[model samples]
Target: MRPQQVIDGDFTYWLGDMYALLGEKETALRWLRRTDEISNHNYPWFERDKNWNNLRSDSEYQRILADFQRHWERYREEFGDG
Candidate 1:
């Protein structure tokens, strides 16, 4: 079960990133959003990944970034850094 969770998140993230690099914005966003839903960690890489540079100026991309940040804030509230 744990392995499946890891596999799902990691594989989905790769698919999303690949689609983004291939210029498939809509499909990339769909997979990327699922990566977030299942993994919840790839958001930090959004701004730093050169592969995503092409998506930087997209309105939907920005909205996704904001949504990821809000998700992070909620996570922090629920689980302190410790």
Candidate 2:
């Protein structure tokens, strides 16, 4: 029997980065948004990731930063700053 597939948010996020690297911004954003939703905005890979460097100048990238800040605030409220 074949094992069931588990679509991880992290994996999707990485796929998004790959899409971005390949110059598919819309598709990359789509996947990245899904990743963010699945992770509830707490995806750890975003903390110090370098792959997103290509998107640094995009408005969407700024929005992602804002999302990250919001996630950090929520985390602090829920678990206290670590």
Model 2 lDDT tens row, 1-82: 1112325776777787888888888777777776666654653557556777777788886687678668868888999867
User: Which stretches in model 1 have alpha-carbon errors above 4 Å?
Assistant: 1-7
lDDT of 1 at 67: 78
Model 2: residues with Cα > 4 Å off, grouped in runs: 1-7
lDDT of 2: 0.69
Q: Please, what are the lDDT tens digits per residue for candidate 1 over residues 4-79? A: 3454877776787898999999888877677677756645666587887899898988887787777777777899
Clashes of each: 0, 0
TM-score of each: 0.73, 0.72
The pairs that clash in candidate 1 are none
lDDT of 2 at 44: 57
lDDT of candidate 1 vs native? Answer: 0.74
lDDT of each: 0.74, 0.69
